[model samples]
Target: MPPKSKADGAKKARVPAKRKLAEEFPPGEVLTDNAKKKWKLGSAVGQGGFGLLYLDSSGSVGADAPYVIKVEPSDNGPLFSELKFYMRAAKPSLIGAWMNSRKIDYLGVPKYWGSGFHEKGGKRYRFMVMDRFGVDLQKKFEENGKKFPRKLVLQLGLRLLNILEYIHDHEYVHADIKASNLLLSYTNPNQVYLVDYGLAYRYSPEGVPKEYKEDPKRCHDGTIEFTSIDAHKGVAPSRRGDLEIMGYCMIQWLCGRLPWEDKLQDPLYVRDSKLRCRDNIDELLKSCFPSENLPEEMKKFMQEVKALEYTDKPNYAKLRGILLQGLKTIGATDDRKLDFGVSANDTGPPSIKVRATFSRTLKRRGRTLLASHNAVCIWKVPPGSWPMPAEGYLPTAVIVCNYRANLFNSAGSGW
Candidate 1:
């Protein structure tokens, strides 16, 4: 994946081309002469509410591959936010370190190729080219009869936890974590990737502690069914929020539906259900899995996460180890192969592209990193209100308030 040559600044003009933010491009349009000649646009591979993804001329929608062109209305959208994130924090260099340190060649993230503006029908749009991914876990869950095997569910949790650690270490929280956002690498089923960072927020500035305050407008910031309690209160994202969201994801993956899945329209109802279930998840587990006890390790992991303050740094290794041990206890190997047990008829590679589009507008989401004067400031949620700790529990909030994170630095040092 190639890096974007130009650096983005506050109020900087859109690069490679600039157009009104509301422009959109349809099929058969060529964004650039260079793009037209090299990476021709194929069919409209996938379409979401505000944007449409097209397969590169050489790429196919249902084929196993590693690249696509994502387009959004130029001015303000998640795709633009994602472009900045990849260009800065989630750069190849950051992922490279994880790959080398973990003795794995790939970090569960898409390879960013480049980004620029495109035009069609006299309107300009923002576009990014990056690795194409195969079927998302949501579709996989639906096809596999909704419920993920316990082994696969545990392994997925472990894998996503490590990815969350890297993103959180870089000072960002993936506000939205769901089955649709988790994808199997098109080229390698053994590797999974976390995509879409539009809802992600910078919790701290490298090392400075951003005070805890909730923003009313930003409340219920993610998918209602799996959003964190902090988000439900309209606060900014933190590492804990990411983990809490993942906890819900893990439960839904194994159980097929969350206890509050049917109550998405009422965020309060969903939030309260999540709160109750978090305390007595064993009963929930018994009902869902029928044969398994509450995964004590998972319960402990969520408990510790809930105890952290808004500005606290998560114990990534400890949290990861909890999930890893769960896998070990189940006698499952971390071969990176998703353990959904391929049946005789399921021998071929999956033949669908996994992309999700949300209806929420970026305009409604408030200040984007693209428009902010200070890269990492503002947007937050309250802490010390999680319904965790039923009785005798102590809180240890770890705050490192004297460091800096270069969020979009191309160099990728301490991202």
Candidate 2:
């Protein structure tokens, strides 16, 4: 065999290094943006894959700081990707103009306040400033035992439609839309915001849309359980794909699980399952809500999503109408109130199977269930009380409780 050429070596180059975690910045540390605006950092409250989220404010940073700063290494890719979308489409004035033109009370999109590079300890970091948010929908979903009430689901669908249409019109598609990425307003829990634009794609450039094409290397490029068929096929994210993903989210939120969730490790299997669900929406509903009457509006919503083509624009008003009709059918109005309390709806909480691992761990710990609701248990633990799980006893289930998470230690004890 001939020796490999230099080009072959280049083609086989190593993948890029994972982004470095950001170091903590002390409270009162100040950073300036490109606009010459200074933001003071409060305590670090959260962290993401490549960065730390610090409470921030123009005045003295405090416990009630209304803004957050997401800081990552200057050379990292995720922050840069998100910055592009924010700089282009998430400016406050632009979002305000859209909401005014549409006559909507509010939009779910987060406004981009400011962003710039910061240097500390001889390291450069990239950061963006935005409004602080309350707990994410995923946490709320779990607290409610993985199922949102039917009315709440419809309300969420309507809000997401509004958000999707706004981003789509701005030429971007958020490839990943899951409960974890939808966050409530810090001051108003009723208002939700669609966040984490790291995977946002500019489907169209300067009013020109991209043609449909797929690459094997890009296959299964999003959250496997809820990703769209286009994402499974490696096609670039588009408006229809976002809607399709939203459909999946609504189904999961209402039904507690998707048919293919048990096999999420197999992306191709998951893809084929979604494809089959798209072809036969009834079967999908039946599998999800086995004993219950199928939600007619959900069926209609999925059917509408199925009809969309790769390059076609989505009928946002039609989708919103479907959800609005669903609200009407249930005798609920779009009051814009998001209730996260335990649901007492006719559809009882979906059956939950406690994993064998969790059961075994509980048995080993000699713990008895104190109370149970919707398959989640509640317990009381003293403050700062928690114990390390024995090796090889990983559990997948989370307990539903009313207490705030930070009240306990790092690992949850009382649940």
Candidate 3:
């Protein structure tokens, strides 16, 4: 895409438009010259349950950045559910947006640019323009032979955790959070974005806490494998439900197969298949728990997760830390450097000063592009090592040394 012009950036920075009925037209609908004048349509990208996505050609020219134009046939009910959810949920200050933009870098959730309607062959179609996220997590997993590197898996886990935390915080639930819905930045693999809010909903609309409410026909709203057990029962989802689904996704990524894949062909067999994989599920949970080998803060977070009772599980902060730590642990390599220096001066009396600097680097795969420096100071030395100087004599000495050390400790020997 061309560099974001001042106008484009300002437009991007604006809060997404609220849902409006006028914007929701039936198929065979045509945009006014004003709306048509704003965007130039390009080729189709892909389609989802709600609409077809196309590349935008209008706006500042020469900007290769593509915007997805989502077109829904007019006969379908007003395409406002997803748009409503997107508008309510797309604020950068919101926890979900922050975690998504910073931690996961999942850019699947594109920004809303503009919307319009068109008519072709007597049918009305409504479309909205959004940023086009390139590849998805599913393709990446397949490219890695079904099982992603542990580090990448952990990074994915953390990103999902952040997304869940943000979603739950807003009293909403991402009814759908799966690999296909998870988008990646075009320029970076570590960046993962969540897209397609069509299925998202307020967690506790009407003051009713979200609980799983099963509907066999809609059982597939979210991907079958990544969905939580309660979701199959048709209960409104709880925050844990989202986390549980995320947990399943992580295990699937690590194992190269979904827990219920064998039974996936027959809906009746899915629950049993998941039960059969209980041991694997427990192991996955344990893998994410905190330990001495992991970052201390992360371990503390695992402790928090362990402490949570079924009804008392809304600790977004702890969960976020745990997921981040797990992500860091995957393909974690630590580099530490220690520097020591000494200075002395003498005249009538003598004095000396000593200083040390320590630094560490933690590396992980998959989310390396999203990495940021986190540092802590361990110790400090006081100054007072030299005597006072005399008018006729003066002496000084200085020593400096620096060394590097590897501090990373992992549960497994390799990824």
Least lDDT summed over 10 consecutive residues: which range in candidate 3?
A: 338-347
Error of 3 at 108 (Å): 6.6
Per-residue alpha-carbon lDDT of model 2 for 1-415, expressed as tens digits? 1111112221111125465889999999999999999999999998876789999998998899999999999987888889999999999999999999999988999999999999999999999999999998988898877888888998899999989999999999998898988999999878999998988999999989999999777787777777789988978888999999899999888888889987766777888999889999999988887444367888999999889888899899998899889888867788889866543332442333242222221222444432323333323322232342455433333344444211111223333
Better of 1 and 3 by lDDT: 1
Best by lDDT: 2
What TM-score does structure 2 among the candidates reach?
Answer: 0.80
lDDT of residue 65 for candidate 1: 36
**All-Cα superposition RMSD per candidate:** 20.6, 11.3, 17.0
Q: Rank the candidates by lDDT, best first.
A: 2, 1, 3
lDDT of 3 by residue, 1-415 (tens): 1111112221111113342222233322223322455665555555554456556645532336465566777545435566666556664345445655555434234455556567766666666666667777767666655655445555566656666666655557775666766877655544677776665668766556644355554443345565555555544556666766666665556555654565554544665555444424344333433221223433344345444443454677666666556544443521111011111110112223334322332344522211222222111112242233444332332222232222232212111
Lowest summed lDDT over 10 consecutive residues: which window, candidate 1? 1-10
**Which window of 10 residues has the lowest lDDT sum in candidate 2?**
4-13
lDDT (Cα, 0-100) at 374 in candidate 1: 18
- Can you write out model 1's per-residue Cα lDDT over 1-415, one digit (the tens) per residue? 1111112111211233343333334445555423453455656677644677877644333343345787777675557677767776776777888778878666676666667776667666777777778888878888877767667777788788778877777777787788888899877787788998766677777677677787776666667777788877777777888888898788776656666665566767866777777667665555554342356666777777778878788887788788778777656657676767522111111122222222232222343222212122211112443444444333321111123211221111111
